[model samples]
Target: MTELRDAALASKAWPFEEARRVLKRYAKAAPEKGYVLFETGYGPSGLPHIGTFGEVARTTMVRRAFELISDIPTKLICFSDDMDGLRKVPGNVPNQEQMKEDLNLPLTKVRDPFGTHDSFGAHNNARLNAFLDSYGFEYEFASATEYYKSGKFDEALLKALHEFDKIMEIMLPTLGKERQETYSPFLPVSPKTGHVLQVPTLERNLEKGTIVYEEPDGERVEVPVTGGNVKLQWKPDWGMRWAALGVDYEMFGKDLIPSAELSSKICRVLGTQPPELFNYELFLDEEGQKISKSKGNGLSMEEWLTYAAPESLSYFMYQKPKTAKRLYFDVIPKAVDEYHQQLRAYPGQDLKAQLNNPVFHIHGGDVPASDMVVPFSMLLNLASASSAEDKATMWGFIGKYAPDATPETHPGMDAAARYAVRYFNDFVKPEKVYRAPDVQELAALEDLVAALKSPEAALEQIAKKNAVMGNDEPLPEADYGDEDFLQSIVFAVGKNHGFEPLRDWFKAIYEVCLGASQGPRFGGFIALYGVDETIALIEKALAGELG
Candidate 1:
């Protein structure tokens, strides 16, 4: 327990006291094992929003923290409520007309126009799985359709129904409804009909321990439940699930605070332990509106991977308080840059201290010292200047110098690069190597190049030039040129300004080339490819020849 407290305190990103309290409760209530952790979200009714990842990413941190403190083997379950009915069409999803027709049914019942899967639910599930997998999350995905079909949730459902009145009583105030008569507490999706099940009159029969429902035609029926229709309504579902799963901790958005409050009441009624609750702020788009699939304003996890590294994305999710404030995509690059700087600052310190910092909010308020390290992109650019086929060679360099760099550090990098290479053939552009440079950047870059007499001198000149430019301006872009010319510029820059110990130099190059201030390493990138080819690739970029 003491060690656990120390770990929690050490991780500044975490709400140490809150986490500690939850762990203490788990220890008291069930000393045999810690609680199960469930992270749930709706499927990609459209593109999966960044907020969805926020929930899961934060949960991963809490789970990791628990694992650090105790011997509890935490299970992080990412349950997709794909069986839920679609209330509206999202911007990213196609075939709007067809979706509208199936919106009333469970997601699994909706036909998939893309044909990648059997249903819309399956398609979205696949996408979500791909996104989570890219993040290196070890999550057990439980689809609502599968859970219902497999009967894994049957017991919990029955229990909720048995406590119907209590559940309704707990939920009404939260919903600000006079009574729970308008709609049934259950979602009421008919598994047989593949449509919504509408019961006009739903009443709890406490004595009979059943839920009595009346059809439109005036036919009445009673569905028997175990424990007197003790099922929980939506508001109390959180507590019910926590008890059933023995969850130690869970996080929700502020929008769900009312539900969480009601859930606490249910926990008391059920006489079962409830998981600790951590509420976080929602993610907003540039518009300041909540980033939601319904609004079609959110950034998808896939889109993020297309441009940024996985560690950057993870770091974005890692640094904030779950309950603090809204997040934006525009802030991500800075977070990534800071993560690199932090790693470099205390490189020789205790691995834990080096890895742990609350600044890059992964969990609520704690960031553990990460054992994983990867070459920054700037460093990679420096290396690419030396090696043309830089991918493999860069990886080898990483294996030697940064062995701790895991797949999570650079998610989808290989696959994306492979895709780009396959698409463009042997003519992949330099912008692909780094991000496209803007107009002002081109002038600045030309000036820096003119100042250099050799490759090493170019590096020093570039660094000095950048220092003069300050942080307010964008980075300079490379001018259009021949392969040999591009090679000379890259070589000159690498000689002086390049990061040191090779890895650092590579990181520095990525920073300079992309104008990102920090990115993947250069040495490994050059080792992955030959120097001449890489130079040619940069020339192609300057000329705007490759896509």
Candidate 2:
């Protein structure tokens, strides 16, 4: 494990140089065993987006990295600012028009449209929890409502007032020239009149650091800090929390630059230690547009998990922490296969060693020399053989490929293997299988099928024909270049036919080509899967009963 750590230190993946510098500075200033906290302000105004996961996932990696280096305990604090007033209605909510009147109140005061929870904030919190739980992250959620109600944040609030002048000095420069005076250092909600104290500046008592409030009659009243319950403005509040919580590190999205700037000022004012900050770029779709709930252009973690394993999803998150990158729909399957390959490569090493290896972190581990070694296509093709075959069947095939590959009866192995297979099925869509063709195309496919005797020979001929004709070449009038055409050819020749839907047939073809059903072009797939087996399987499917 120490060797692994040494390797990680030497490797580029760990970013050890930057981390060392940051850690040294942190240790010098703070010294105390502060909780390493990752803070994200959840509005509960919309469905949690991929960006939410992006923040949490990256923070988790950093926390893990810290744990790897030192014994300092870490806490990933997911803060839901449900006490925040609703600014606008979320698109998914019903009767959004009614929310306008409810805007000024806390999110906890808003009605839940789904009728499943006590309030809108509660509903959103649960949804976010379900999403996070799927990733197996160990996290502690702190609700703004709960924190305020429990008075856990009171100490920081008091510190903000004491250091108010210093905090103002840090914050005022960031605001625009026109709005600088209007921006107060705090969000003060008066308990008496429910009126917010929207003061412009520290108007009086500069020497004593006391805030002076002017009465309607023009008399100045100095408010003394009797206890640690002063409402520090947003910027000061952030800094105060850092000192109060003793957060060693936290990451935020690039979009939160404004809030981060303000928080920095507050930290200076409160004279508290500020956490190390890592800002990550947002996840974009294939088109290079940022994934946003407002735009409705991104896939949620739930949707991604439907086709990919949690580990694969985590791998995608880990690949690059701060790069502005696009996540194509196809990346998941490759990730799944790569994850399994990594697991196999580090067969006997302890878990810690496997995690710290950069090669294992990215491309994946080498296949274990003693493990069952079947081409991915074989397992996928076998899966296409029947809907019931699933991941269990795939495991059986791997075991059969290597007699030494026995069923992992242990709970851990079974769970891990199940995750790998599920990821493969959901994320990898085999492209080799075409859709059902019309009768005319089916007839042409049948004629083409007749030209082959051996599966290998037939696939070779097809490849040659494809090479000579080019991918754009027109097939006979009946050929639509879809799964039905391929199935008709398979039906014409007897092969490993399975009892499944037409969709499964296409999936089987993909399995035969790529270890997963979704991937590169079919011509390339044939090149990869080998021509002989490709044609033989087609012949087998064509000759056998539809089952």
lDDT of 1 by residue, 298-344 (tens): 56665566545556667676666553434554454455557656644
Question: Which segments of model 2 are wrong by more than 4 Å?
Answer: 1-11, 15-22, 26-30, 33-41, 116-118, 190-235, 348-533, 536-547
lDDT of 2 at 303: 71
Give the Cα lDDT of each candidate: 0.55, 0.56
What's the lDDT of the predicted structure labeled candidate 2?
A: 0.56
In model 2, what lDDT does residue 185 have? 61
lDDT for each residue of candidate 2 in 1-547, tens digit (9 for 90 to 100): 6875565455455534334445565554545655445565565767676667767766666555555555555567887777665667776778676765666556776778777888888999998888778766678887766776576776665566666667767877877997776666654333433233454544545345446554334555555322321245555656666776766566777887778767866776666657777777887887889887777676677676665446667667776667886766656556655655655667666555665543343323332232324333334444444322256755654443344554553333334445445544554333334334344434433544453334453454444555543654533333323334443344332222221443544444444323344433333333323334445655554544222
Q: How does model 1 score by TM-score?
A: 0.63
- Best-fitting candidate, measured by TM-score? 2
TM-scores for all candidates?
Answer: 0.63, 0.66
Residue 113 shift from truth in candidate 2, angstroms: 3.6
Among all windows of 10 consecutive residues in model 1, the one with the lowest summed lDDT is: 419-428
RMSD of each: 9.6, 9.5
